[model samples]
Target: MIIINVLDNFQAALEAPRVLSLNSSKYFSGPYGEDIVFIANDWHTALLPCYLKSIYKSRGIYKNAKVAFCIHNIAYQGRHAFADFDLLNLPDEFRSSFDFIDGYTKPVKGRKINWMKAGILESDRVFTVSPHYAEELVSGEDRGVELDNIIRSTGITGIVNGMDNREWSPQTDRYIDVHYDATTVTEAKSLLKEALQAEVGLPVDRSIPLIGFIGRLEEQKGSDILVEAIVKFIDEDVQIIVLGTGKKIMEKQIEELEVTYPGKAIGVAKFNGPLAHKIIAGADFIVIPSRFEPCGLVQLHAMPYGTVPIVSSTGGLVDTVKEGYTGFHAGAFNVECETVDPDDVDKLATTVKRAIKTYGTQAMKEIIQNCMAQDFSWKGPAKLWEKALLSLEVAGNEPGIDGEEIAPLAKENVATP
Candidate 1:
């Protein structure tokens, strides 16, 4: 009900300018949403585009406005009972837009309404976080979550997300104790690693290769696979630290690793921002074995800190992590389902071993230098976004705007919910 009311207020605001009066002395006027480009993110605000086309546009309101739908993750689509569609108070003609039938089930469940499907069909443009993720979404039903056909027809754009260099940089990070750039990373990391080992109750040894894992302990994050892989190196010269909070089973599995191998591993099943920074700064390598990543920020954060990443070669991981240059690829797995694959576990273990072999060598230093030298900041990605948004303004035109584009106008009018 609140969402519906908010949408109604949004439409009203767009339909006419609002006047603000100060005690008979001053007045302010809000813009009547002209040439505005609305950006609806995920399922929560999916109905905004539909309302614009069906109600407002039919009555000649916000006619020049365009809406772009951004899909951060396709797994959740705001599925609800078909009968609940009445609560939206939409026209009967728009019912088909939200209608969805789940054919994968054995008993063939009753009809449901999907908000994301409607947004995809109605929006002017569709976007995902990364290029590889965009391709994967249109490739098949497995990654697309049963919306591949619609996504393919609509044509989605992909732009890799960027990190805030100011906050994530080793020299400027406020969370970690020690700070260093590429040149001083080796000595600084040695000190951080020892400090981290003591903080996490592990034996402080600078020679041991410290590996870190930080993210939700969910099936999507491949936490089970990580635990399985780390178990293989219990008796080895490696040290592991994991920090995250999710799924009781996964949390228990991580705790078991700490109990089983006290010195080699420690798992803190909670979110600690400072601890996360320390782990990234201190660890020689960070493992991100996600089943599917739509432009992961952790690898971007890890690289600048001289921490090599060992990741699965799927989605944004493929785009960001260069094998043997910046990080090691753990091999891409067929993401047909959420079940953990034994092969993926083996592949990750092998990649970890490979990364361990490169440790403490001049080759390792070169890789670290390469990782640090690369830029994952917002400047490049911001330009790509500018190009994408401007392309919307000139749909069929060739060689759109110059460097000084209408990016500011596009940025100013974009309303996201």
Candidate 2:
């Protein structure tokens, strides 16, 4: 049987075999020679998942059991895409731990994916965070490689994400004024709404509905379309509260809108988790205007707070947020629409207006109730991994597997890149 380890270092999955860190295999294609799979996410900060999956395959690790990961943003190739952070200013505790790679600049290339590809190919399985994304990465070829073929050789799983209790709990929250849980959903909602409005300097008029738009302000995040839509809708009864900073033009427009529609539009150019949670609790609806979401955590945060979501139908949003249940679908194919443009100003505004109307119905209430009841925990997913590891068939390496029989995977035997 093959044993697997799940590293909690956020980028442990992305840095499978350590992409940013220098490696013996960085310049060479692998015949990895050992079995070890790393479950990586965070594509923006590291290599595309399959490259590493393939890296493991080439190494002959998968001859016994394939190595895999839960990938997010697997195919995103946008400009200035990598996360920009002060790596040098990392905390004293973190600094001492990562002394090996002080000048890490970039990850391995996707086209030269053999090293990563070999790992995945040799692996017993590869699990993705979103079923749709698993289907996407496993279906098409982009530049030089065929993603479909790469995925075919490895078993890909679509494991939906669960929130960390340490971070998302409302019981001991420091951000919200009131701390409550699923049982006190009603009281929590009301309190959060009032507190959020007051914090944002908006009126506490119980009659008006507030719309919460939070997250990074980028096209994938759906802020560009939202700016255009809000311009057209421009309603007095509906207030829009936005948290995050991106796109200078969008920020300026949001600022202008707040002035133009005093007490209606509030924009915060920063990420405050407690504030974000309160905003979710207080709002009538939450909008996850993502173009391609691979299991969004925000949609998860909103449902339990009784805030309906207005999202595009894609990735985890499809699995988690129901079309007409926990939230309404914006239904615009913002991406890959060559013939008909995704929603223009008029259509975007119309959709928001329609969703707002439906949000007030008893039917909407039932949908939220259903969403809250669903399980969003890691216990179930951990069990699935346990089963795969337990049942995995193995053998020692042979000439067929590169030389001697492929050895059964043990934690001590799993090698690094």
Candidate 3:
């Protein structure tokens, strides 16, 4: 059974640089002797699309193999049970409807064990998207006891998410007005001007630096800090571009800022794929002010396009964005964010100014262009899972044991206002 867990991938990747292949087995195929297992990225909401994909893959290739999903983020809030066929994309931003449902209903936590229960019992092996995410399931805050039991019984592994080089390549991107590799800044700048301005819905002004931001509007990615930073820098000469929608407090502020900033601030609060790539390719600088980024693709995407990133030091951002090389990093800030205090905003603004200064200078831009040329596609990530899935031996056994399954409760469904 070949399974690809893409829970809510299209929406999670809505504002990502390119549209990820929803067609799972093709992206994650077993070489010859290997069979695939299934999982979802989000359990509460995006489960159905992935489930459908697994069903499709099973029918075509591994008809006899049992395919199932390792519920993604089952412990996101707490344990919650997921309803059958809750896969259709639902809008939670327009109204405050999802609120009473999330806090009171407690949906996400309900599906924790059920998701794993299904994965371990049915799948030869369970796979996650990232090593970090895998760790969470193994030894996460909520999964402490259950994770161990699952390990004693069920086998699980983390596979770093992959990117399509075809879509992300700088050598040939229609999104950028100028197509250049590491050695062609002159045309890139021209391309940056026309392509970015048009892409972001801003006027094509080569004179000003175009700034870009794309991600979920939650504290996990330092969404709160980013909101503050934007508000702080709204009066500056730079053109700001934002994508994606999440959380009421953050989303409302962004909308208000859009009204306040007008043409200077461009935002698309829906699932838009192509526009995100254009923004990433066209922008002078990309921002990933994450509070705790497990493994971020945006910063990776940002670099290839000569888009210097300004990220918070944590998780994947720290691993990918080297200071003064691909991007700049500010130190630790948690969910509560007491460490960020008032001085944090100044530092963020300073970082942006510095990155802009770096972009404006001919020598610095060349340095940035050099960094972006490096590859970060699916080849490496796919191989890790490819080996795991094809091997199918954890502790020299194929069938892993089952742990205690949690009682299904109401789950949480999230969206932006």
Candidate 4:
């Protein structure tokens, strides 16, 4: 349970005159146990050096520690300025290890290091959030841009991410007006649909399928494509409810769409977790037309609420949503494509229409049932992660920090650097 809060003031740390203000001296004294998990760039980039220093300090204590570096997304690999490398205070021998050059394509840049790449190179095991995404990275889909070659050689595994089932359960969720599961979800859904429509000031109609979009308003999430499709189908018999805010231009466009379609469309420009749960419980279909996704958790959260997800056929969306079974999928856009086009819109609209037509039909009910039957809970993934860690070979005779030797991490033991 120990949560190290390192450099609480990020801006202050950045503006500090000296590098030692990061307090590596105090944090490096701690001992490394049998396992260490490097999360995304924020923590991994900042704490990696401290962890490395600590490992070097406690060489006797952690001779055979296993490290796992989890890549949530490789698109935004931590690429700080070359001058900032001095802040890491790494020794001369290891300094060049972090030094990276952009040479996969044309015109090699001088001395730019990717922290994510460094983590991948350093870790005992590497993993991403989904199997398909892991494949994509190694396949050079996105130019193999960041460390695809290294990743392929080093072996990166994919373990689909899971959600907190208890928090997303439709039968137990407190955010929704009514609680129901697969068996009684139909009636509950109808009631919640009307409630949601009235709450958002839509026409309170159950016949028209209410399509909900609750993610970032960015091209990567295919917000542009979604907005285009909705605008194209403004006159169609459906309601659009957007529950997220990003990209000022897209937000403005969404608000404009809301105004143009008055009661039929509404864009609540913010991230409200409870509202998201309510939207999931109330909407007939949740749309996630991401251009690229490592492993999306929103669709997983939506499924337990008996909400059918209409996703782009890529990454975890493909792994989770079975066509016409749990839900439906549209086009699978590749990295070579500059932008999502009308063809993508056609695919999206076709599935949306299918979902609408199937409303109240036996097929729709079965689909909802199938979605609810799915187990996207974290239990399986936790076991898989544990198995991955245990598979690693221990090299030293030094005493391992198993349950018998070391106490569990507690809040009291959290070191503040």
- Looking at model 1, report the run of 10 residues with the lowest lDDT sum: 408-417
lDDT tens per residue, model 2, 238-312: 888888777776677666767877777888776465577678778878877666676788877667667778887
Report the lDDT tens digits of candidate 3 across residue range 56-126: 34456333333333443433422333442233233322112112122324445333223333334434456
Maximum-TM-score candidate = 1
lDDT of 1 at 15: 56
How does residue 310 of candidate 4 score in lDDT?
89
Per-residue lDDT of 230 in model 2: 76
Q: What is the lDDT of residue 278 in candidate 2?
A: 74
Write down the TM-score of every candidate: 0.88, 0.67, 0.62, 0.81
Angstrom error at residue 353, model 4 = 2.5
- lDDT-wise, the better of 3 and 4 is 4
> Per-residue lDDT of 1-417 in model 4, one digit per residue for the tens?
112343344323322322323334432433333334323232245435334444343565344444567777777676655565666545545555567777443223466756676677766778888888888779873634557887897898888987766667888776877998777988899999999999888998888888888888877788778877776665768898887777898888777766888988898877676777778889998989787888898899889888999899887888888998999888686443356677887777776777777877899899999999999976677677666766775542232222221223332210000
Question: What CA root-mean-square deviation does each model show from the true structure?
Answer: 5.6, 13.0, 12.1, 7.8
Off by over 4 Å in 2: 1-37, 42-66, 76-124, 138-149, 152-155, 181-184, 247-249, 336-348, 389-391, 394-417
Pairs in clash, predicted candidate 1: none
In candidate 3 the C-alpha lDDT for residue 304 amounts to 76
Q: TM-score of the candidate numbered 3?
A: 0.62
CA lDDT, every prediction? 0.81, 0.57, 0.56, 0.71
Candidate that would win on lDDT? 1
